[model samples]
Structures are given as structure tokens and as C-alpha cells.
Target: MVVNEEGDILLVKNPNRGWEFPGGYVDKEETLQHAATREVREESGIEIQVTDLVGVEQISSKRLNVFVFKGRPISGELSLSNETWDVGYFTRGESLSKIKLERYKERLLRCMDEQNTPFLLES
Candidate 1:
């Protein structure tokens, strides 16, 4: 997830899944860092410097490899895209309540850790 200097969490209003951090599957021949930067730009129309690979969520039933990256916004204004309806920043406590899905909330919490230990969350 990308955060700004004010300690607000960035959220994208996904048309299908409600609110979530900007992320998607890595494209062919793309590095994880590149994928993250690309996803953020595509969903939120912002540039970010991906700081670290903070965690991974391994969902068995869905067979999804979700990589959680910590990032800071470097450029661009808050704009909407085809996949996301709204882009906004909120506080940690605010986001905790606003995010609709439990699993997505969990992912955001994991990535927000100050200690930055990589996690393997399975479900």
C-alpha cells in the first residue's frame, strides 16, 4: 500500500471488489517492483517509489499470490481510472473501518507494520 507524508493510507474504489490498495498480478517479463509501480499508476494515476516487499498473501482456494509493497507517492494528482472509481487518502483508523472486505483489511494492516517483517498470510 502507498502512503503519503501525512500518514494517510491510499485507497482505490475498485468497481468489483470495493476499496483496496493499488495492486494487481505482475505482467510478463516485469519485476515485482515494476509491477507495483505500474499498478499504482494504472489504478490511481500516481507515481510511487516502491520501498519494499513487505508481505505475501497466499490464498489456497483463490490460488492468488498477493504481494504487499510499501510505497510513497512521488508524483501526480489524485485521479480516477477505468478500474478504480475513486482515489483518496485516509488515516489508518479511518481505513480500518472503511475497507469493506475482511481479507483486504487484513492485507492493509499487514503492510502498514512499522517493523516491516515479511509475512506469509495463508487462508
Candidate 2:
């Protein structure tokens, strides 16, 4: 999930779930990075670069592995698809309450931990 320069986190509302980050299962022969970028674009119509693999979530019931990646918006305007009912950026605190599921809210908070981002070295 990507946050803007103002520190607002991006969120997409799924029909089953309330508000969550844009993501889905990685397709066959497709790269994880590509999948992350594509999911965000398809759901929010925003281009983003996958910056880091922040965390991994396992859905025991579905036996699914969700790779949570942090990203930054590269380009494109906000647009919605059938996958998402709404798309927008929200403050860190707002996100805590805006998300319906408790675990989903935890995931958003975890991504906000900036230490996950590796610092680039400079000579």
C-alpha cells in the first residue's frame, strides 16, 4: 500500500471488506512487483512503484498468501473499478477507524512503520 507525500494512506473499499489496500493474488508467471503495481492501478487508477515488501499475511481459511508491498504513487489520476467501490487517501488516524476489519486496520498501521523502508546509501 502506498501513502502520499502528506502522509495520507491510500485505501480501496471492497464489497466484502470495508476499506483495504489495493492487492490481489499474483497471476501465473507474473512478478510480485508487477502484481502489486497492477493491483493498485486497476483498483485506484494510480501508478505506483513497489518500494518494499513490508509484510506477509496468510489467510488460513482460504490458504492464501498475501504479500503486502509498500509503494509510492508515480502517476495517473484516481479512478475506480468494479473491484473497488471507493478509492481515496486518508490520514493515519482516520485509517485506523475507517477500516472495518480489525486485522486489516492492523496491516495498514504496520505499513506506516517507516523503518521497513531501506535507506539508500550515498557516497
lDDT of 2 by residue, 21-66 (tens): 8988788999999989999999999999887788776667777777
Q: Model 2, residue 51: what's the lDDT? A: 78
Runs in model 2 deviating more than 4 A are 115-123
Question: Which ranges in model 1 have alpha carbons more than 4 Å from their true place?
Answer: none
What is the C-alpha local distance difference test score of each model? Answer: 0.88, 0.83
**All-Cα superposition RMSD per candidate:** 1.3, 6.0
In terms of lDDT, the poorest run of 10 residues in model 2 is: 114-123
- lDDT for position 38 in model 1: 94
Candidate 2 has an lDDT of: 0.83
Q: Write the residue-wise lDDT of candidate 1 on 36-89 in tens digits.
A: 999999999899998877888888898888888889999998889999989899
The local distance difference test score of model 1 is: 0.88
Each prediction's TM-score versus the true structure = 0.93, 0.87
Model 1's C-alpha root-mean-square deviation from the true structure amounts to: 1.3
